[model samples]
Target chain A: MQMEATIAQSVSEKVKTSGAEAVIRSLLAEKVDLLFGYPGGAIMPVYDALFHYQQALKHVLTRHEQGAIHAAQGYARATGKVGVVMATSGPGATNLITGIADAMIDSTPLVCITGQVGSHLLGTDAFQETDIISISMPCTKWNFQVTKAEEIPAALAKAFYIAQSGRPGPVLIDITKDAQFGEVEFEYSPCQNVRSYKPEPPINPEAIEQAAELINSAKRPFVLFGQGVILGQAEEEFKSFIEKTGIPAASTLLGLSALPTDHPLNVGMLGMHGNYGPNKLTNECDVLIAIGMRFDDRVTGDLSRYAVQAKVIHLDIDPSEINKNVKVQVPVLGNCKETLKHLTQAVKRKSHQAWLEQFRAYDQIEHEQVIEPELKPLGPELTMGEVIRQVNELARGEAILVTDVGQHQMVACRYTHFKQTKSNITSGGLGTMGFCLPAALGAKLGTPDREVVAVIGDGGFQMTLQELGTIFQTKAAVKIIILNNSFLGMVRQWQQLFFDKRYSSTEMVNPDFVKIAEGYGIKGRSIKQRSQLKEAVAEMLDHKESYLLEVHVGKEDNVFPMVPTGASVSDVRLS
Target chain B: MCKDFTITVFTEDHIGLLNRITSVFTRRHLNIESLNTSESQIPGIHRFTIVLNTTEEIVQKIVLQLEKQVEVIKAVYHLDEETVFQEITLFKVSVEQAAQHNLVERLIRDKNARILSVEQDFMIIEKTGHKAENDDLLEFLRPFGLIDYVKSGRVSLIKPDEELKNLHELVNEAKQANNNQSFN
Candidate 1:
């Protein structure tokens, strides 16, 4: 009886299937439950296959191809799993370029499948044909073009593996239409090895010891971490490492929510609009340990004058990032989860009371100069910071805060509180506008239990507002707060600070955003008065469905603690 | 601070890898002086030899970026003084012009060039040397009505190491261990 069953299973597994069906089966094998995409001519066969598999694979039809990709990014960031995106050739594939680049720089894992023209017509300028594999080469971690149906199963298996392994980034697999329609014997085995790709470097005990010794003997050691901790799922390990040493830590923009916002040693955000304490004290620390974060120019400010007084220790999964930016004294290369555990075991428990107090002193100065006025402004006009403060009060650090670019993004990053890892999703690397609306919808889908709030500026809100249809269709229950300044706020701030305040095409004659949301059948409110702020935010949050709240904020309000271009972090402004 | 450097990359043989590798240079606005690719000593693996003139800092960054490519196993850059390198150039000259200039024959023989073919209309001579030597021969042949000339990119071997072999052995051992663990 057992032999008969085994033979039957083998026979069933060897059944012939179309390449499009194989692609669906491969996704099933990878345990992909949700997909974000748009349907078009080149991808019609795959969409046809998808119809029969709707019960198993849920597909969200985003309004635009760019919206689909960004939504996939949000899903990946929220769930810590590989996000999947599908789009047709040409413009459909090109629309994914921004989000692909964003995923690459931020290390979000995504597997993007783009349909191409028929194999015979690939280079012949067939309708909807574009060389996406070549176009995405610079951005994707790896990419392949599949011209034969027989290659579908293996190509998709490899795509999932490459996209999710070792310093994860987006991977593109372009399939010709003929290949999708052709028949093949479907078989799949998850790729275990690629021969050429080594995802994780072996941890060196000696390097761990060297880093520990440096940390132990240092007068003041500071930790600057990025999304690596969360990407590696090493948040607990990171917390233990910092808590044992009692060293105050700051985070790069994407690194927020990896460590609890209210943790004793959690200092603040780091970058151009970062807190005054971390920026000012960067030069004062004797030892700087950077984990899972590259020293971006925004974070480091002037490299020549940044952390020159410190002996740096960098722990990262990517070896190329070790000396690519600021030079490090000890380089620990491996998954930070394992590396942090090993380092935590090696380092001694100690406290830097005086060093921590120095941060508090600067924090006090910053609160007086920057934070207090913005969050609790005496001015009649609403401030972006106050809207964030209200949302933080209502959500209580539980909501997933997804933000778009510009002043609202900085303000939300500055004021939003997060208690759990992966709770803060934003366009960190690309600074992409119009990212919040669709990304919030995707985040809500990925983590259905969490409240996903999107804080967007007036200018950015208009970019992807078409996604209100997506919200209405899916009923994603995303809470969107638009800080309406009626200007391209960040550029205006820059012009005010450096460009002599000549707002060149920065002002906007806006539309009725609430009416637009209502047109899409989503509930919304437009508020300008401070008295209505609390109830308006509460109403948006309390609504059973997705809601939009547009608050009129100060038009010329600028984000402070700014590190002027080419200036040192110590010279961060507080106006 | 700009100086000539040779970068050798060991990678898995895969389609589109060359594009992936070159785009790193293209993105940085760095121009390649020459580039060559072929199978390496190890079975199934490919090697890339690229020559460029850039600041050491920029070259180091470029090599690091190249190593970041998925198919690329390893990438290392070497200063000109650290490696022995040469390029193979083929010159096709008009037979009539070559016979008119007796000095061309002497120059070819003096430079250790070999006559590969002699057709009625053209003669083909091959020379293997560094860029300077190849350029000198080209200038000499230009007066002899050089019909066509083509030179391959620099092919180099590091002076004091067989690092590629060592890396291959290490990779093999790692693969073996992974297989054993999976079986268990």
Candidate 2:
């Protein structure tokens, strides 16, 4: 670490007196080595200060503010460090909100610094000004407005600490123009405490003991792992516990990479649109030890009827998550790693051979027979399952998969087997669209050496298509596949199930993706028929720079055998 | 981890404050082993306390939560055992006819306590503040005979730090700047 000498303790040290300089100084003290952002008038102060610190920090200019925030998320998710992004006030700030909420829901540690209109004009409905603090409150771990330049240091430092500390989440610090321009002696030290925030720790000893007792007592013991295990770095410990107890494990989409997909005990995914055996096992298991995974509607249809036969033991890091959705008979709150360690010590091996045999038999039967009648003529020349299988083959057990929200995400969930948790990134809780393009850019940037593929639907890719410019600008080689069916796949599937197939505004008009990619000065290809799928995917694979591979699939298709909402687990509708 | 804490709060439990209060107890890494909340008849007021263990930062965070609660009028957190004040409970005893007369005036003069009820069997006395003070008075009043007593839990407060750099100076500067900008 450079011993920065006699750093400006007060405003006088700035070669330029502005809040922007203080922001730079604060960031420097916080040892912020990199920043992701887009420039604008409202954020000029930040840029001005940033110029002086070029030697100390690196900056990546995203094509849009939204891209910048997702890049930050990618940075955070990959490194488990606090991701930071900067943007101009108004639309710039608003643009970053979805990404901010995305990080919030996923509990990634992200710090977003946005420019704000000056204090005098705050509440007057000033042009290009949004009440970012109020707007981001529910979506942030905490939100603040630094109306004064002097508070900038503390606020930013506090933002980083809170973001990286206990049960990390996104935090926003809105700096007003005056504060950005104003100068003060900048002192950067983390705030030891913030009044309004309190993150719960892992469950206490008694609770852990009771949880272990339940696990030990069950004849058909199984674990439903979620992203929390990844966040807690409990993969090794989790494997250890399961090895000792011989529990069959299934992962939520976010927990895909936690266990190697090929493990015998690994049931690929459970719930609607998942592997039949796993979903059945999930329903029939006597005890469902759900770790870190919330009972998202997609994962657990009909909360009342979800795993009705089983006694669920819920373990999560957040107290609000314990009973907020699915009611669990045993609620254990704590870090997933810590809680798993306690369980490993407290539990003993028990046999569930009869239970295991039943599931295995079902697995063989389901694997041999068609789970659902193979997608017929209208169901597209290629099923999502086939695409994932080919993609995984091309992936060579390496490249991280980034997905946007929709049926494709489900297809990816049931289809791909991950080697580690967090290897699969998606908008889990906040299922935001237009999420993949930028998030892939961020992920590729975070891991430039590794190949990264963004598996996206037509509806989502359009939301952030502007990012092709960012890819061209940065020359980030991220391979993206537009699962183009000319409709919002998930909503269409919903309509097919719930709304009488009255597809309202779900169909998307045609766009020449190749031309769009060309407009951004990148390579693009279009696949119109089944014979073209491999060729398009091959072209994307060998492309030297970012490529947009548009695969035209059928529009009438649905991710079938889906357990419709409000339907019991045992009542899944498989045609 | 084994965490322990001793805290006392002075406040009014406004609607929804109890949840806000306990929410902190649950949210922060504290395991509330025991919690007590009861009426303080000083109009819309109540006293609540929690015992738990956690880091100093978490405890201060809880204090900040208490201060932020809309219903909590005031909050005090004390850690030291000896240097805080607590309410003194009262005890009454049967007095022999001869000892009763002297005891009444003696208790009143020494402890500044008042006798609320008097009967051949016993007199009810009330004393407030330090436990030691109440004990001294109870001894004199016990001439009748020892009865029963209740001492409220120890409520403690560490003296607030003397103001160093004015924390509100920034607010004042912002105010002045606002005024100047408005004038322009």
Candidate 3:
């Protein structure tokens, strides 16, 4: 340790470094390998410094700033590390707003660095200058601006710490141009503690005891978890706790892959368009143990009627989230791993076979009414579920599945199977349409050994279709599957069901996605008929390089088992 | 349900924290009527007083959201009757009006305002009072040649019994926490 310290000191003294160089050194100190960014005038100095550190780090030049940030989110989601994104001020910074907001609501950890105009020109409305810190304030977990060269390392350390710590979310650091170019006596020390911030608040022993006692005494217990399980990297802990108690577990869309989809205890997804059983049984469960899931409005439709019969025990790391929505009878404020461990130790070993069987009965009903028909449709028009079904079989439920937001995202989340943890990534809260392509690129890069597949809708695919250039440059082996229905299917479905079929602007006339893939120097296949689905998907998956498979799905198909707008979760439709 | 609500927040002086704090109002679609920020008596601590027109429910939610901010020490909302507050208004008027008529002097006497400066082009007058009193003085001075006018947001102090002890305790705890940390 002394020798390493001496070496670090000598290295710092050898280089009379600018703040840009300090930024690179700090990132290296933090051991960040991959960076997604775009270059502009304000951030050019950092890019210049980045050129020197190219040997040690990998910088992915995405087509747009949004792509860069989303890709960083993908990297973070895949690696459970802080994703790093760099962009210039104004337009470059503003372009990251959607991604930042997406990462914020979805709890993706990202460290975004934006370059600002000189500090002296901040308020004068200098060229290409925008109040990025102010603009990103609501969306970021923590954000700071550094004008002095000496503050660069500390700001960056804090940014990374805040981004990755406690219910992880995006954090932004705005660096002034003068600071980037100004020289400083560089010394990098990682941020350990923030006086005003407490990432992990102390856990309440009484809450855990009450939770355990409730779980033990319950005649019918249920477990509903979400991305918090994945965020805490507590899949093993959660599995142990659930298996010990024999509680039926339902996952939020973001929590899909935290446990094996095929696991007997893993009930199904819980929300609109979710499995029939979880939504129906939510009202009947006696003791609902919600772990690491914020009861989003989508999950708790008609909040007054949601889980009203049950006594809820919610274990989460964020204290503010405890009673923000659904009331919790026992609020265990801690990370899922710690809270579950404590609860598991005290909980009585019991099985609720009767309660578990009720979920299976619901699953049977959904399978016959919705799942079977969607996965094996009789109509001439192919379905998104069939395509996902084929991908599920070919990928053997092991591939990392990334989906853009829309009908396809829901379809993928509903149908795709994952045998391992961290295999599912999507924009759940923000519902950003163009998240898949760039995110897939980052996912493939982050987990290069694993099979990476991106499921997107034609509408969403076109939103960030420009990232094909990124794929062409990086040669990422991400299998792109576009469920092309030639319309905004989700919106079209809502119109069909709720808006008196006012189609209006929901229709779309798209180009040949195959031709577009060909133009980007990627192999492509198109399947228009149901008969051609298996062969085309097989061919796309078998191809050596990156491949795009466009499956023409039914245009007017509506996602079923949906709780109608402002309706109770128990009122899910099977149509 | 829509009535004026004042929210006071104690926090550390972190750059862009004001933006982060204000963004909560923006996200909830609540309009900020007035905002004032200044250093607190406790060293290294800052306080922000934000006024908005919102329902009791929305104000409660806003305070909760504000307290969730990493830099924010504490946040609470107050009704009109709960706090003793004042806004300082500076009225700049044409010098000719002050010289010609005793109207300016008489108004100043009646309003309990003091002349800040007498310039060649304009004379500056300062008034400290509740928002209504300041507005009333402005209305009376409207007949006079007014050059410019500015009013600060409500600088509020909570009633002794209503003042939060938790905030002061939290600030002290934060200081103690920082002192124990050896990272610096």
All candidates' lDDT scores? 0.90, 0.73, 0.89
RMSD of each: 3.0, 12.7, 3.8
Count of backbone clashes, every candidate in sequence: 0, 23, 0
Model 3 residue A496 distance off true place after TM-score fit, in angstroms:
1.8
Worst 10 residues of 1 chain A by lDDT: A3-12
lDDT of 3 by residue, A12-114 (tens): 5545689998888888888888899999999999999888678676899999999999999988898888899999999999999999999999999999999
Candidate achieving the largest lDDT? 1
**Residue A418 miss distance in model 3 (angstroms):** 1.5
Q: Write the per-residue lDDT of candidate 2 for residues A1-575, one digit (tens) a residue.
A: 23244243432343444678778776776667777999887899789778766766667898889888988887677656678899998999999998998997788989899999988898899888988876776567766778887777777777776787667889888988888878765555655544323354546888888888888889887788888888888889888888878888888777788888887678667767766666766778888999888778878877877777888888887655665566678888888788888888999976566776776786666555443333223454666656666677777757788899898888776667677556787888888888888888888877788778898998898888888888888898989888888899889888887899999999999688889999999888877676676666777887878988877776776775567777766666555
Question: Of 1 and 3, which scores higher on TM-score?
Answer: 1
Kindly report which residue stretches of model 2 are placed more than 4 angstroms away from their true locations once superposed: A1-18, A29-31, A191-203, A368-380, B1-184
TM-scores vs. true structure, each candidate: 0.96, 0.74, 0.90
Which ranges in model 3 have alpha carbons more than 4 Å from their true place? A1-15, B1-6, B52-57, B78-152, B158-165, B179-184
lDDT of 3 at A564: 86
Which candidate number maximizes DockQ?
1
Instruction: Please compute DockQ, using alpha carbons, for every candidate against the native two-chain complex.
Output: 0.43, 0.03, 0.35
- Model 2 chain A lowest lDDT segment of ten: A3-12
For model 3, how does the per-residue alpha-carbon lDDT over B8-75 read when each residue is reduced to its tens digit?
Answer: 99898877778888888887777899999999878888999999998987787788778778788778
Q: What share of the true interface contacts does each candidate keep?
A: 0.44, 0.00, 0.46
